[model samples]
Target chain A: MADVPTKTARAEWGTRFGFLMAMIGAMVGAGNIWRFPYVMGNNGGGAFVLAFLVLLFLLAVPGLMAEVALGRYTNKGVIGAFRDVVGRGGMVGLGVVVLLVNIALMSYYSPVIAWTLYYAVHSLLFTFTQPGFEAEPFMLGLFDNAALMIGLHTVVMGSIAAILALGIRRGVERIVVYAVPALVIALAVMTIRGLTLDGASEGIAFAFTIDWAFLTYSDTWIAALGQALFSTGLGWGIALTVGSYLREYDDVPLGGGVFTAIGESSIGILAALAIFPIVFAVGIEPDAGAGLAFVSLVEVFPEIPLGGLVAILFFVGFFLATFTSGLLITEVSVTTLAEETRFTRTQTVLGVCGGIWLLGLPSAYSVDILDYLDFVFGNWGLPLATLMIIGIIGWVMGPERLRLLAVNQNAGIHVGRWWNPVIKYVIPTVMLFIMAYFAWENFGTAEMIGGMLVLVLFPIIGYALMSVIEGRGEQPDTADLTGGDD
Target chain B: MALTAEVIGMLAFTLLAFWGIATWSLVRTLRQEDRKVEILKHQDRMDTYSPESLAELREWIENNPNDPLADEARQQHNECVDALKHTDMHYYDWSSEEIDRLDRV
Candidate 1:
């Protein structure tokens, strides 16, 4: 392996505290708030939770730690880091896969963040508290208002761009340090309020009740695994990019990787605590799908005490979770561009944000496009990239070697030898099984076909365009591309 | 009724405890970092040692084999010599000043 240069100036996280908070902020997002509750409601609740915890510890934690180890060890963005780790050949292809995945995800994800922002402001203005506020029609109205959707989209993307342009310490770290704590506090308050509601125990019992029969269904296992993976931000290269700024001495095993997983999972449980009690107290159907947060919760709020204030708190919390996540998602592209090209950070941020804004128009204008993009990126692209990443770490690099060199080297708590078999065999086997199951179940639909085409074609086009750009000699200084000073 | 109150109390306590632990950990990390910086500052001046000074010290140690301070000089010279290799292995291009600045956190 060629030695990475030692003397290129790169930004580092201000402190371990800042790094941990930023990572926790990245993991605890809209998935924890809206998606986790409904998934638990639809699945077997306590049984699903058990399976999710099992998959998280066995598969997601190791995968997350591996990505973090790769980033910290290489001290470069995904492209340069992958190039260094995987060596010269196949770097561009793998790099494009990781890059395009993040870009495509952010293209759709920003519109959702815009939705939360609009709702947060709308709630604060007492709009939801108005007489006879119809939740479904109102939500549909907002979605169909093209001007408003695009405006909120611009606002969300612009805020992320402004924060990222401030650099790591002043921008990302400062916001997350406050944002994560605020999110938890808001959730705790809402949880207390929900639990205090008159008929809340039924919801809590339903959420925590165990039904072993559901474990027999493979669908339960797949949904649990999907939630665990997506909720923890595995295979997204967002963690990998965040880990790139980690100091050499920061611990990966316990303080960095495992801690982030625990924090994120705990927040998911807390979200269930906050949401289920209210839903049960109001006697709403728990399996409300994507509308569980906006429609169902909005319906429940009007019938309860302090419901207006609680609604404001919930939407505000949702906004914080989503906005912070959008920041990290966009940072992946911003950092890649800044490191790869001769462009200034400002130019890179604006260009990336502007491009995403234009690309996200379809998702903003139509719910069908939004759902389709989410299905393509979420189900197929994310899992495929994650499986490839795990394969690289396991079979290509040798799991034991990665553990020794990347993980245990600077870690505060070293993983046991059990990690070897888990990373090498168990995680990859489960991931392959999940991918096969998804393909078997969803492969025939028109949406699936369209998703598959986008999944196949987006990266090939991205890789080709990237190759052309690299060939045109727009590459930045090699010294800068490598970590450290020239 | 008592059990319901107990459950609520327990849940509230657990949440508060977690927040307390997070705050304590942050404080402890900052304090530990401060101690590390202080120790690094006083332990040795190797971070500031120049190449020419290192070479001169090595030669002095070699020539003054019987001198009283020769052992200490040799130790300092060896440390200075190893510093370059350590720098090469570092992940970030952190200069001594930047390191000091980081320590201020």
Candidate 2:
């Protein structure tokens, strides 16, 4: 029997230009700049880079296509899409996890964005020109002043909310058109600047240099796979959620590939340029963890002539990067509201942003707790959530049917037939293995494993409870996972 | 640290705020859905029988028996006066606007 074809409510993009830029902005973020270089340094640089590219082709892009297709077809947020196809119980589990992760993300993420604002203002005021140009002092200057940090963070959050409040077409898509391109230009400038520096050869060498032996370590592969997924914003539901707004007529598979490729390569190159030159110039080790972005780099800023200007641009760029990620993070929650409530666009925006703001406090104030939470949510929670998304859409969606959806989405674009195999078997298997491997590698100690499980599983368990409360007990329709095409 | 009255008060206030928003949104959603459902039911009932209408109605009833107007059509079909002979589309005429409206809702 032919089901009635309802009008698929496609949320309009501000423009085709806005659509492209916003998608790219969502894809590019701090991971490309702050996280990529540091992780690359630790792993074998060239070898890790090679495997990462391969993994992106094999697992990440196809998985991304499935998500985009699901979102676009269903025209709903993560939970709404999941529930409509998978039933209420399946949805609750996914929704609660997504909500918790977005909340945790904003908590510390806002503070980091605040840090960028602080640096931007300091650079503009030429505050760093004061004689004492040392890392400890500069680092102390920003973090110690909580009030300053809080104010800037608030300003950044306010700007982000104001833009989101304008609705998707005007606010996000329009602003991102400029923001993303400017970000790319800034990165290019930084890369050129790095190359001109006296020690830039070393910086270039540091990035491109290979450690083939390092590839032998399974942990390196695991890290590379995770980085590929997380850095591209795969496990986050941000891409899928945003892509849900796209019209069915748009070529989704092509959009997915282009977004993923540009995001990965640009961020990869920009991160290398931004970090390696500074690290090489200062004689600092390239492999220092998260601290490299904040602590070590600020120390070197004072010696340069236009140190303040450079710092201002660098941090401003970071702010944009984080802001892009943060907007998507907030969007995940806002979309939940759009699906669950009849609140107008404005109300839903405020509701989600405000909710995140309140939830964000604990992480902002405490680094140690935030670190623990970040590990649990970013590393473990996101992968688990993404795995569910893939399985729900891939296997449960009927393999043949899902392939047809993929083909339909790729009508004008050329995604080879091989995409089906990757989405169905290769991607999910790789994700599962990496997730398990990371869990094993990180959770070695019994106490550590137990504590991590408690933290991560609490949200999952709570979601299950919510599902029972709201769901009308029904098995998820594995056959119709893309919520059926009209 | 031990729980204090201040902390308890804050928790209570937060809970109230969350509950208030959730309840407000839920009511609004349910109301909107109800309005849409009512419109759909009305359209389904007002539709008449024709050759095209008979085919479409038969398909709709067969596929969507749970739809609100399905019972009305069932009663009409089962009426003693209009037994097997009048069941065909020749007995009734339907307007394009009516059919379009039925399709819309």
Best by TM-score: 1
Q: What residue runs in model 2 are displaced by over 4 Å at the alpha carbon?
A: A1-10, A88-92, A287-290, A410-412, A444-471, A474-486, B1-105
* lDDT winner: 1
Alpha-carbon RMSD to native, per candidate: 9.8, 15.8
> What DockQ does every candidate get?
0.04, 0.01
In order, the Cα lDDT scores of the candidates are 0.72, 0.61
Scanning candidate 1 chain A in windows of ten residues, the lowest lDDT window is: A477-486
Standalone chain B TM-score for every prediction: 0.38, 0.33
Model 1: residues >4 Å from true position, as ranges?
Answer: A1-8, A462-486, B1-105
List TM-scores for all candidates, in order.
Answer: 0.81, 0.75
Tens digits of lDDT, candidate 2, A253-364 = 5455544444544556566766687667767676553466666666656655455666666767776777876777777777766766678667888877776666656655
Chain A TM-scores, per candidate, are 0.92, 0.88
Residue A272's C-alpha lDDT in candidate 2? 74
**Model 1: what TM-score?**
0.81
